[model samples]
Target chain A: MTQASSPPAVSIRNVAKSFGKGIYAFRVLDDVSLDIGRREFFTLLGPSGCGKTTLLRLIAGFETADSGAISIEGEDVTARPPFHRPVNTVFQSYALFPHLTVEQNVAFALEEQGMARDAIRKRVGEALEMMRMGSFAKRKPAELSGGQQQRVALARALAPRPRVLLLDEPLSALDLKLRKEMQIELKMLQEEAGITFLFVTHDQEEALTLSDRVAVMQSGRILQMGPPREIYETPTHRFVADFIGDINLLDGEALPGGGVRLEGGTVLSAPHNASGKVTVAIRPERARLAPAGEGALEATVVHSAYLGTAMLHKLDLPGGGTFLLRQSDPTEAAPEAGSRVGLALPAEALRVLDR
Target chain B: MSAALRRFFLLSPALAVILFLIGVPLCLMAWVSLLDKGGTSGVDWSSAPSSANYVRLAWEEDFDGTMILNTSYLVIFLRSVSLAAVTTVLSLAFGLPVALWMASLSRTGRDIMLLLITIPFWTNLLVRNYAWLIILREDGWVSRFVNMISPWPVQLLYNDAAVAIGLTYSLLPFTILPLYTVFEKFDWRLLEAAHDLGATRKRALLRVVLPIATPGIVAGALLVFIPCLGAFVTPALLGGGKTLMLGNIIQMQFGASRNWPFGATLAVVLLAIMLVVMTAMALWRNRRTA
Candidate 1:
């Protein structure tokens, strides 16, 4: 839906960063590299302490990388200070200036850049308008609600029109309804601004909803990078599959010529042609309950939850492991808990993670 | 006990101290100010009361309908206020950065620096003033150092400058302590936020850090300025009998001149100025917060 083949706005090349010193030194980002395209909405998704925020800070030049290079718009800026780099960040805490009005907060960067007073005022007005916070221009941050403050933070960061915007969990502080509203709003705003956004978030749903391409990371490394649908349906790593969504991970042995022999002698076609032991990953929404005599694995429905549109069932497989299933048809009756049923996991719906 | 009574009981000790120790002496001073002068020792309460002591502050009334404004006491008051203001400015300039640096330091480092700040307080202020007199007097090390630079020894001791130095040295802790407390609550993250907004370090300090620390700045100024206004010992010892601040004049009125009523009137004037300044500051602070 948006431009995807533009030149990269930022190029982080083999960048490595660590914290502490000597014996206590621990690498936070180990040989991490990525290209964020201009006008592309990119997200760094991972758990806490997974170096996602560290990578964002490194790009903003708030912290320098230990080795390798970071370039923005083909210009090397790894050694540059934060102010020298054409990048801005939306902090998790929404760090608006408590002493300043919303207009002054948004106009700060322009004022610092020595822009004309009239031009700074116009730009601040336009940014506030985009955030739908025009009337709140005179209000101090302490006088505003949390969501309103978050909008002010975004408006301030965007007022400078930096080459790239780095967001560090900017919506995590909002309540669920507001977070959902802002997720769609932020995605639309990124599209409208046409500037690259390198967002870091631990919430998988947030990354999936806002990002054009999501990079799933863990510890100090990027596990996989792809479009949201591709990342969710065909994850290249076990961590990615599990982190992205609820997935049933079954251990199986790969046979010669694109075949998998799961435990209990159940055979299924393989998506990958490699021959080795692999972790079979299946999403709950894809797995279906079939007649007992016709499915790949017989399972007992141990638990069922009616989730409005879909009925979720925790099925205990014949091989002693349990897998989750979601039946989307509301009209059909769900098999009672503790009743035996068959699960049909199509070959295309399963991914065997290798690395 | 009920919560209200319990709170009162908890506060009674401080209330008692303020009532008997501070309030009783103040009332006695007021009564003494209304009494007739008894030549050179104390006020004569049995003698008919008169307003001559208060009148002497600004005007000297002649029996022949001629009035002259005696400005010497007013000059001393102005001099004392100016010296205290100078000390306050100097202390804030020096103390603010130290407190900011201390705020940025590691906890143990800050504790050590605080200890360094506290250690000087353990020594007596009189002892410190006498030490400064030895160090800054003619033929002292400071004079010898100045003599090397110039042909003759500079008259640095017993001047306004020496008094200023003594006052700043004595009241630095008062200036620094409130600022340190203010800096403690300052969120260093605002600096990063400023940096992210394309603000240089200098810009950030002016726009962000300074505004956040204003409350502390105001508090430290009051703490330093009020005490410097009434400073007696440092100016007395370092003044070498040349400089006459309000404190010295007040001391002379009661100690040497034995004009108890006049001394009490001057004390009341100083007290009134302090109360007015404190009340104005508190009201301004409250309005801003509200």
Candidate 2:
């Protein structure tokens, strides 16, 4: 039974998937549920083997859930095959047909639908121009470099005008510089096309840069789901905090108020509701390094790495615990290794997360 | 010695063997083909050099036209190419799905399927043709069983149909093997990519699977067509000796007629045709690589 006239772009509920027989069975997805809004750029970010790709496949109708319902545009598409679904994916390998010219590869799906030659030509031309690949349309996939082929793959996927576009680490095959460029191009393309994009990637930076909202998955479950800044600044769980970006976690006990007491007998205030044995997450940039007796905790600078724009300091606390600090000013004098230093945990920058 | 000279020295043995064996015989064949035949004294070379033998072979003997016609140069060439094409299509139709299924199977299952595909290659080609001969005869088990089922039994032996069938059967493994290799190594994510892009199963197969498998299909087609051109055994046996194929005519000229010149001419023509086909294939392959 459906309650709304217009449904969400993608709706998945209690999906489970397993491979092999009884004794040899391996569960890859477990009770996974998600709802992607229409025309929203959604990302599933996680470590390898976290079932993010499987979840994307389930949404794309390439794989069926063992026990759940999937709906697209309000229709229950649980048994619908991938071809029937209004979805398209860009594979990580680029997957361009070697025998076809770049234009032919893009026009393939349209040709399969028996679209007229004129229309196919026009649409293919438009898509190629959109991807800035107009010049390479006549070339074979083998003739182009890695990044060019990736653009062709993107053009081919976008030419069909599917309701949803699924990208499975489409830029993972590129080198560092090309990958960065493609990330911006991909985000812009998704926005220009106005199609719901369900991108799957293990790269945290990619997820942060491209998604309107990201679902962080681990061990077949979504640990947290929110915008990049929200997920990075105010992670709701320990797993989310650690997976998204670099964070210095301080093991502490929850106080009566919205605060935590560190093992070093230092008290820090937080923004989340918490009680009894809790972990507070603070970004490396949040902590300021100074001479002992001037800051919150007595510590020693173990090592400092100059990273051009910033300097990263590894500090050892008095309680046999170590913390990392990232400072943007490389010109500031950082204490030498083995020198006693102070570690400052600013109340505004610290977040208490439930374990 | 320098690298180039040392390499030349290393290749001298093979070069010597080629010059002594292949090059010398080819040159002799060319000379013999040009010689004038004395009535009972065999070939005469002392006479003034002329295009007489080539001219006589083309106009007087009429063997050239008959041999060319009998070879069904047009039909056999087309038929052989089409046979390879059809076999490639059929093998992909059957083998690709089977290969995809096999690829999806467990390690043990894939090994078992691989063994099944390899089973045909292990047996001798002559034995396979003979086995087919037994199965396709007028009173053979297949015909007999069909007769029992239907009032009239189908006659499948000794015709072009039977030849095609035998050729297709013999070359099935060749087509399937290359296709299997292509399908086995195919990235399944591409199929997923097509589906995510709103392509149906049929479209995916046509667009993604077929185009990507072109290399294997072309390879399989060449494998089947080249051997099928010189197929003496299958056409001779399955075609019931009634068929005047080039192979049979060549055999008659060599064995019964003793016209070594005509037979050599036919052999040279067939080789020329093969060379043309092979050259075209090589060009196409090079273009693909480029």
Candidate 3:
């Protein structure tokens, strides 16, 4: 079934959060504004302690903003409590009731709504089947594996059919292989359920793979918001580019034209106009390595790391700055340690940011 | 020494202590329960092994039935259970909120409240029991103040009601401790998870908090019930012997009645009942866990 397109599921405007009073008070979230589209999977990607989870909690109505308005489906819900909000969260720890069986946990929200017994049974069975956990309905949470417990937690949240679903680092607890599998399953489930999803995670790969749009946050403020491709290819700030993916930042001064002068005194043209003291960022994949004396800057190979599919090389520039280059073929006759190398950076690949 | 010999040597002292302190008394009690009661003349150890004491309890001596049937005894037992249950319930009702409040407080505030809760345990149990008696007596200060305010004077001393009050007062802290232990460590995110799933405050408490707190409730109930069953000072002083309980009866048989065998038998029976109750509780707990 196609996902339904409606008005924005949640709209947060100028939200700020602070804890305690006076000297002890700490501001955790500052002037954060966001609009989560209906039936869209949106993710807040950031480093740890960046207030992304706080923003998710605010949208879920768990924490009230100190000053601002939160609206759901065009209705003002700034003062509403979590119970009154049409949102459900799959916590990082899952938070499954240890005392309850899988079935009882899945049926908790329905039971709270005072639904009919037969209806609850039917709905719980359907939810269990949806999560592929029908065989584990009688088992408690402690009996299930991490991935199974996570699926049970998801089923429990989804059974109530809330308009919006909040996921707070839902896959941070799983192994790499299991996390990848569950990520695909979670995306499929979100599509089938046709609900708005606000996923909070510090994993850039998870955000890039799952979210339709990603909001990169830093210290309680959204630094950049865009589609995954746009965010990765064209970051507005150095932090966003470095955080979203690995990049080598070179110290440079803005030239008279649309070019930058590297610290090594080599002039390179940039796609964007450089202003004041600037740093140019280029992805490792974008920089090409050649023999010394053939390219713009000559540098000696300091170290090389073999990463199965790709080989990463560390080069020492003449000006003492180091640059990292990635090559797919390690078996190729590459520069060995102490061997000098040339660095080729394309102008299109260089992004200039004003410091 | 060899490894096996050294291990045996290390275990010998504990085993010796267990044999002397526990095994010997248990064997003596088992031997006593099967002996014939020597009326007046003592030391009839050669009597045949029979169910005479148990049979006598059911048929010849109405003491067993009377002890079970006496309104005062039944009232005291029932009152003890109800009092302990009520106290435990009240403790949960009152203590849970206090614990939650304390849990939500700053570290210094939590420490202060915890210290306040623990202060009562420092006083002697007898002193605490007597303190209740002084406060609740007919001519006591509390009764005097109430009498002045009311048209009729309310007597709260030397009665089953007084025993109940004392029992409840004595066990209030016991109930609060376990409830506090569980509630203080309760993860608040679970409540938030429940609310995000659309449960109201009352619904979340009933569905989430209560089930998780069942172990604490059970522990607190046993802490109150088992002791209140054999409680002596509270009933003897506050009950004035008019509301004699099982413990007082056992005490009478051993102290004044001079029936050592009967007292031993009653003690064995009380121990058996307690064992049964504890065993049932353990089985229930195990089943729930399974």
Candidate 4:
């Protein structure tokens, strides 16, 4: 990651926006602020109506923020219209000009900038070639497949060489297999272009796979922002931990002796230096199944599911809470349904979430 | 029945209507246009078919019994075409912005505007033309207002300009409705995409919206132009017999001159020109698609 010494590629400060007016007004983005570093692939991850897409649109100048300011590459662009801004966007629908061929679509921005004909031709050719769409340059967008149209959209947005590229769920239209293929291509393209990419997606896995950092949003607020590993392993918010991946949370009380007391009167040794009520969160893969009455917590196995690469065991704790353990070792026998088992919760793997 | 046979059966009713309403009259007109003019019966049923009436469009027999070029009919034809073209251009100029504005309005606002546009159509065409005659007459308020601003008296009625105004006023809705439909279905995100790509509003409109709405614009133009070319009431009422068009000349041939062959020939020629224009447009559209 680049140091904070330089101005970030895009900085959003205290931006708030709402739709409608008066009592019926709905706040879509509330006091959102973030800085995306140069050449970094940053993603806003959230579910629908989480204001992630709204924030991206603000950066692209499609919608102006009701309050606060937005700057691109150290230049204030909050008051400027979309045409005056230096950034481009790959819209979710691709938004390729149906009348123009792929080459012309990629050349549109350069033409608007009054570039020379020869330069525009060269740039359009290079951009299309970079997207592996050189052969289809003469075809209109309707003639191409959805994935090919997506590549053309990317090419068009990148051809202008904007300081930042905002993508609003560009891969949501593609099927699962095509979405995966484009995800890798998108990452490589970001690196090759050497520009900051602000991507918005509701798919958490996509965000984790493509972004250098991910910001989790809910109710128009950024709950947490960090590297994917940090956001996944040490999410400060309970929503983030559950939204990112599958995790088991148990209600417990912190004891003065540096351990947690379960609701069912079971005490397990923990390493956190906190006292009072807390929620202990652990990923299913982080725990293991032990023989009955031999591990940190005793439980009865409810069922086991085969997940091709791993086996998932659901257990009912004595406190009536459920715990899941993921076992990857195929050689070990899985506890059958209704069998009693104990769960080993490693101290380091346990996260103490207060909210 | 098979799908193809079922489709044929389903289409036969429409085909029969077209053949009876459109096809039979066209055949009758063609046959009448090929005959010679009869004294009082309008056509000589026993005369051999000939191209004399068609020739009469461009040539006239002089007192010396020699054919000479006739510029009178040519002038009328040119006037008719030029007026229709002017009406089409004026309708587009006044209708495009209205359609764009309507498209940008809220759903309720758009529906209200659509109702306003069609309200004029509820009135009879002859009554509307008479209203324009009243509005554009010498002492009428519109004409008096124009005269008030001018250094000299400005005549607003009984000219090609007045005919054009009446024609455009009557046909404005034709241009607005189709263009409105196209704009309503337009993907406005394309404009946003253009703006995001650094195009100013005007440039985006010129480069994106207008090109996408080409089909609608052409349809509107045809809707106005085809009818304007053969318009009889507006020219006759507003022109005050000073300016003659193809429709007026054809009307005179059948009503006053009792020359049925020439009247039929004019109608056939008008249909032929419209057919050629429509065919060319279809061909051009197909080529663009290809």
- Identify the leading candidate in terms of DockQ: 4
Worst 10 residues of 4 chain B by lDDT: B281-290
Tens-digit lDDT track for model 4 on B1-290? 99999999999999999999999998998999999888788988888999998898899999999999998888898899899999999999999999999999999999999999999989999999999999999989999999999999899999999999999999999999999999999999999999999999999999999989999998999999999989998999999999888899889889999989999999998888788888988899888767
Off by over 4 Å in 4: A253-277, B1-11
lDDT of each: 0.89, 0.79, 0.83, 0.92
Cα TM-score of candidate 2: 0.83
Best by TM-score: 4
Structure candidate 4, residue pairs in collision: none
Real contacts recovered, all predictions: 0.87, 0.76, 0.89, 0.95
* Candidate order by decreasing lDDT: 4, 1, 3, 2
Model 2 CA deviation exceeding 4 Å by range? A1-6, A255-276, A288-296, A305-311, A327-336, B1-8, B17-21, B26-125, B137-139, B156-160, B276-290
**Regarding lDDT, does 2 or 4 come out ahead?**
4
lDDT of 3 by residue, A183-213 (tens): 9998999899988898999999999999899
lDDT of 2 by residue, B1-290 (tens): 99999999999999999999999987766665565554443445565555554444334435454422232344544554565455445655665567567777778987888788778888988898899999988778897887779866577888777877887787777777787788888888777766665577777787788877878877777777667766777878888885445566556656766655555555665667678887998899888666
lDDT of 1 by residue, A304-345 (tens): 998889898998888889899989986688898888898888
Query: Residue-wise lDDT of candidate 2 within A1-355, one digit each (tens)?
Result: 1225567888888999987789998888889888888878999999999999988878778787899988887789899888777777788788777778999889987886689999999999999999999999889998999999988988998888988888899889899999998888888888889888989999999999998999999988888888899999988889989987899888889988677888878887675677888998889988888677877778888899999999999988787878889998999987899988777778788888765
Model 2 residue A151 lDDT score: 89
Candidate 2, residue A244: how far the Cα is off, in Å? 2.2
